[model samples]
Target: MGRQSILIVEDEVIIAMELRETLEHLGYMVVGSELRGEDAVRSAGKLRPDVVLMDIHLKGEIDGIEASDRIARSYDIPVIYMTAHSDQETLSRAIRTQPYGYIIKPFNERDLYSNIEMALHKHRVKSRMDGSPEMVDSAINMIAGAMVITDPQGHIERLNLEAEQLTGYQLSDVEGAPFFTAFGVSVPGRDLLIEKLLVSSEYGAGSMISFPSTIQIRMKSGGDLLAHLSTALIQEKESLQIQNIACLIEPCAPDTEGRAGGYQGAAALVQAIPDPFACVTEDGGVLLYNDQFSSLCERLGDGISGVALPINRVLPESFIGSLAFFHEILVDNQVVTREKMVKYSTGSIVYTIRYLPVGGDTGGSSRCVALHIRDVTAETLAMHHCERAQGESQNTDAAVEGIGDLCTALKEKVLAMSTAYEQGLAFHDTAHERLAEVNRILGDIDLRLIEIEKNRWV
Candidate 1:
């Protein structure tokens, strides 16, 4: 918020003094001046000025350009080149440093002020673009409640840290096994109904089904929890078929509504995700989808239940074209991530898509895939605008620089013409004097010739 400080790195004592005076007159604080490139580099790293005015030809072996490079790599400070030399090789080397501005010497007050201000503005803009991290791992690990994601066929695909703590099973040991086997779930009174629902054809395809009775889940450590069970289906986008299932168990209090008709706890975990999530089969069937997915479908005018829209229909065309990349996860069983940009009538939307393969086989292919989609439109737009701002700023600086160069060239040509005109005037004055002298000599010779003729006649 205060006046910007500048570090002057010039070899010539008079020039450096003049530069310091000019900067101070322009309301910039001139920090300690350094004549040597090595000294300037050290000072820049220590003082950390807003900008550095570096002279191309420094006193020592290390030139201004080299010092600027070192400072740039370490401190990211903006450097403006001050040089009288305009040779091709020097220009090329200086350009590689990408100095904010180049001031051709015998620079005036106006040139110094404009270049320094522009460099400071550019540096500030760049600082804003480079911000802090978006997400923190410690924050995610602190969330309460167990979360379990399973493949289309009900195999335990993943268990979060909370799920591991609650289920008394490490993810590495229980992953790829059936959910019931991993957690050891048992419905004491409604065993028959649960068995039927678990093996039913509709359940395999990720149908939403819940039990009214209390369910008991036993941890591997023999600790048991009595909870109400619920299930939500994640469907594949292409086939309108189910791909995965999410099961939520809540400790049901006595006198709570046990009839499964309107109870919401079963799918509450899946619904808690802020992003659209789905589980798809290896063959592209919709197994399970969260409420966010349903909302997204409705917004896109593609009904999830009525028309069974494929994943491609829901995502942008750019994302759809990369479907093969998603399928590769099933083959290699590694997580694949992709980002897509979509333009709508309103504006552009960016989606960060992550495809995670599911199923428990060590060497075999995965049976299902889980997709977590994040709407990163806001962040993406911010980044785009930032880049565009930086570019426009650079373009503006370049235009100013071009104008300055043209002015400098014009000034040089004008000086050259003035010098030539002065020389011509001097030449003309000398020629006039010589002509008068010649006339005077000729007149005297004529007089002498006349006197000689008169003497002959007498």
Candidate 2:
């Protein structure tokens, strides 16, 4: 980081003097001038220079190559090999130390300066690359965060052990899947992410808004996980930002069932306890509708979910964006609470809608979000009159317990392994109906094959 110091270990006095002159001219401080390999190693230990310039073929059995390796390993010093022995055998031996740079004997001052500068540059770059793991470990490992590094094409590269363990899909299963195809959630601003990402000119064009958003994704086991995501391009090339996406899930707490999701999965239980629930996707469409949810709104159909539901049916179009509304039951993904409300509804009907993240294949582009709905319209209103509302007092407990239970349940469900896996599934209304349906569907083609018994065929 500071002005670099170089330790010169050339045995030839003239060559050593010449190299020192060249290094000094190139804005480097000559820390030590040594003739013997052992002396050079000792001097390097004392000087603790920014770098070491060692000549490979020394006078003793412990050559410059061995001395350089010791200097590097012991003192964490950067070494550049400088020697007249440019032959294949000697050069191969010198390279074992992974020296910063290699320069042949009787090199010119210009070449010498270039090598020194190159050595420093290489060390700096190496330092930068190697610093990341430690930095990442310090920040993410203890706080329960999931860090995913991806290639330019969005294939999974390296996921921390925690991320691999939580998602239920190993790195081998998910490495090269397309980001969208793997994660399944339709990215809200795919055109924008690719807008500048796939092209050279617009890579950093406008003031891009960073969404501190939470979205849901499904796991390899078909259950969903709630991931808190902050979407940004980490490493940028000319056209593409080889991204490093980070996620920190608020650990879901223990429930009445004596379970807890490691992070935010605990609160989803309380969020699911109420009736008349509907989930809205990030793209502003209805994702699901529970049975009681459909009945409350007078809409009933088997295949009513997984499609956009019009929001204008319940509240006036202009009221949707009104800022005067507030809820009593809203809780941060990291915070657990019981009685959050959606006060924006007409007639002031309060509903508890707990949000969860559903990560799909790659997990960063969360595909689906869960809305655990609980209708608290009447209780919420009655509490306004009764100063000593019991439910209101336990609002925090109910909300926390409810969401926590569901989240814990879901977390277990998401990571569960199934041995009773079956392929063909058939559903029917009644016992007779099921038999009839199966028989009709199979037609007269369904005949049992005879099992051959050994020797005793009666």
- Which candidate achieves the best TM-score against the true structure? 1
Q: Which ten residues in a row have the lowest lDDT in candidate 2?
A: 447-456
lDDT of 1: 0.63
Q: Candidate 1 on 137-158: residue-level lDDT in tens? A: 1222332345566776789766
TM-score each candidate: 0.35, 0.29
How far is 52's C-alpha from truth in model 2 (Å)?
Answer: 1.1
Give me the displacement of residue 215 in model 1, in angstroms: 17
- Give candidate 2 regions above 4 Å deviation: 130-458
* Model 2 TM-score, all chains together: 0.29
* Candidate 1 segments exceeding 4 Å error: 1-266, 306-327, 359-365, 420-458
Local distance difference test values of all predictions, in order: 0.63, 0.51
